[model samples]
Target: MKWRVESSNMKQLAAVLVCLLAACLADKPQPCTSPPLLTGAFTVSTQNEELWQYAQFIYDALGQKIRMKDLGTYDNQSFTHDVLLLFREGVMYEINDLNRTCKKLPLKADFHPLAIPKDAVLLGQVVIGSSSGPGQGLLVNTWTGDIGGTYMMTVTEFGCIPVTTVQHTNKFGWIMTSFFNNIIGITDPSKLNPPDFCPDAMTEDVTREPADFWSLFFNK
Candidate 1:
């Protein structure tokens, strides 16, 4: 009986030691706070002088992923771009960048600015030798979605937009996260005014002016 009791106590001691060892191993040191997440109004701009444009973007912080709304205007345009993108959502509307004439389009695409394309090639971390900003980062190159051309982006935990970027094509110009301002939400562009063109259907002005048949007849 004495021997059996000793064995039981030894087994209990062994179990306790195992648990303590596991706890010590799992309790690794961690950073004090999580990395900063973009939540509010921010400005995005391009580095190329001739391709300069300003975009005012607002972020909705109430969801798992912050929702984004972008309002863009060109350098010399009197009015904002007719099209404003709501991230993965379709075209909210198309307005004439020059005259403010507006139309709507059914064009929808699954374009998340932070989404990693299926074919994206992870090219390792950013190095000081590269023209990218300081600090090591995850470098990824992709040729999908609205990128319109191949793009290389350096992602960091600090912000959704690339810390550094290079777009091989001008279709979607390079964007830099310039400013941050906390805001509740962004107003929907569609709600601002009634569409000038077709509100219910997307339209394209394919009409051509009447050809000069008289001139052709005289020349031929």
Candidate 2:
């Protein structure tokens, strides 16, 4: 009887230790890098505004390029276009499919990685769904910081997949939220290439800052 009691107490102590260790691991910040090549869909919306857009995106971090095809209703008018940013070439191409025309502008923004910034403050961690069973819930971390503007981001804890991002800028009165979905590794490398018409794109000689990219879509 005495031996059994000691063994039971040891088991309980070991269980407690395991729980503490797990808690510590979860609390520790885990910074992760996104996959080099990916394709996804996202929705962007402005706060207190009817303006919204749904876009399919192809990202090639390794090649320093990204492309977005979007259709949106702004001010009750439907519009569609494709924007391609080539970091290496320092240029952006805005393509109008219906007119078969492309406008080329200088893009000075550097490539920003999808991972959480080192200076970002962790807001909290939460589960999206039920955490009671395996494969039931997605654990995610929320981070906030100023990157040109105030921004908050939520990403999956395990794979560091971006779930949503909210950005605000006081100077521009801009508040936008974006939600990501259907993200997967890029299957066709050719999808990252600019359209054939881009070679003959008309150059727009307007000076643009990096932040001007967002303003291009939100000009109401």
Candidate 3:
């Protein structure tokens, strides 16, 4: 059966759950955890830099998390897919080297998040200190709803931490290339690969297949 959430108690639930989970990190909680790429809260330096530079960065941060790697760029030149990060509770973050720091974004898997209005919510009022225009980007309170379509959200983060039910769908979908806005929250299942990541971060039961992913940057 598909998961559903209540529109009202979304934020409270998320906060309470996050707290409970954090208190019990020593005990361990289970969700989905097997990804082909690195699935953690990370900052994608998408400043139009080459994939080779990111390769070196990852190698410095995570020596063996990525055993095998194959990154595709735009037009066989310039870097297009800057970074692919995964998070827990169906959430993830990424930033392209194109827009420097303005492109920092987060990817969340809940539907309610899309329905949140910037002026309506209180918790979301935390000043982001962004350099871009004012009153931009989307932040919806996800968790309560009948998910019939595919969704991807990107939230900027200073560190990598797993959240309840969020993961980075970096190299698992065409959203990386065929994107409308910055986030990939809505799409067809046929076009997305399962939530997968790397660094061998697994919680058992959660598995992945590379065949599930599609490379829009490719013509195949």
Candidate 4:
């Protein structure tokens, strides 16, 4: 009888341990990297400025290459451009479609992958939409950290797909919020290639760091 009681107690303890392990796994943060190529649309807004654009981005970590094409309107001005950041070559190409020109300049920064920083602190987890029914809501994770500036990023819990990012820089005295939507994998690899006209483009003597999507419009 004592042997049976002891065995039953051991089984109960094992069941409780299993439940605790499952709970811990469920709450663990899962940081993820984005796809190598993606196309998406985003809107960035600041105090008195707003920019909307469609973006095709390529991120090659192994080769240390990054390219982005942005066609958009900024503060009522329409602009189309491509920023080819070749880290290995130490050169960046800013191709403007409006004037059909490209400016080659020095690459100021290295490639930073589109993933949650390793030191990012988990802010919270929430549901984006209605959770009453199946396929109704998106579970997302919010993370906050400093990367050149203080920023908060929200991404889907399942795929780590970006939903929004808010960045603030005290040095620049600006706070920008961006919303991303309709994100999908890149359909054509050729779209990542530098424009044909870039070979004969002029080399500019500017020594400024490359601008991000929001800064590009904000500075204009």
Best by TM-score: 2
**TM-score, candidate number 4:** 0.75
List model 2 lDDT by residue over 109-148, tens digit each: 7788777888889899899999999999999899989887
Ranking, lDDT, top scorer first: 2, 4, 1, 3
What TM-score does each of the candidates earn?
0.39, 0.77, 0.19, 0.75
Candidate 2, 66: how far from true, in Å?
0.6
What TM-score would you give candidate 2 relative to the actual structure?
A: 0.77
Model 1 vs. true fold: TM: 0.39
Off by over 4 Å in 1: 1-49, 59-79, 86-91, 95-102, 108-110, 122-148, 158-161, 170-198, 205-220
Please provide, for model 1 over 98-188, each residue's C-alpha lDDT reduced to its tens digit, 9 standing for 90 to 100: 5656565433333333334555555553333455665443332222233455656554323233344455434325645433343333445
Q: Encode model 3's per-residue lDDT on 30-131: one tens digit a residue.
A: 221122222222222222332221221121112111111234444346443433323233322233333442122233222221121232212221223443
- Of the two candidates 2 and 3, the one with more favorable lDDT, higher being better, is 2
* Model 1: residue 6 alpha-carbon error in angstroms: 29
Residue range 1-220, candidate 4, lDDT tens digits: 9999999999999999999999999788766776655556555554444455666566565566766776776668887767877778778788776777777777656566678888899999999888899999989999999987888888888877778877776434445544465455556656456677776544765646545634433443
TM-score of 3: 0.19
Where does model 4 exceed 4 Å of error?
Answer: 1-8, 11-15, 48-63, 71-80, 97-100, 171-174, 177-179, 200-206, 210-220
Give the higher-TM-score candidate: 2 or 4.
2
> Model 1 — which ten-residue stretch has the worst lDDT?
211-220
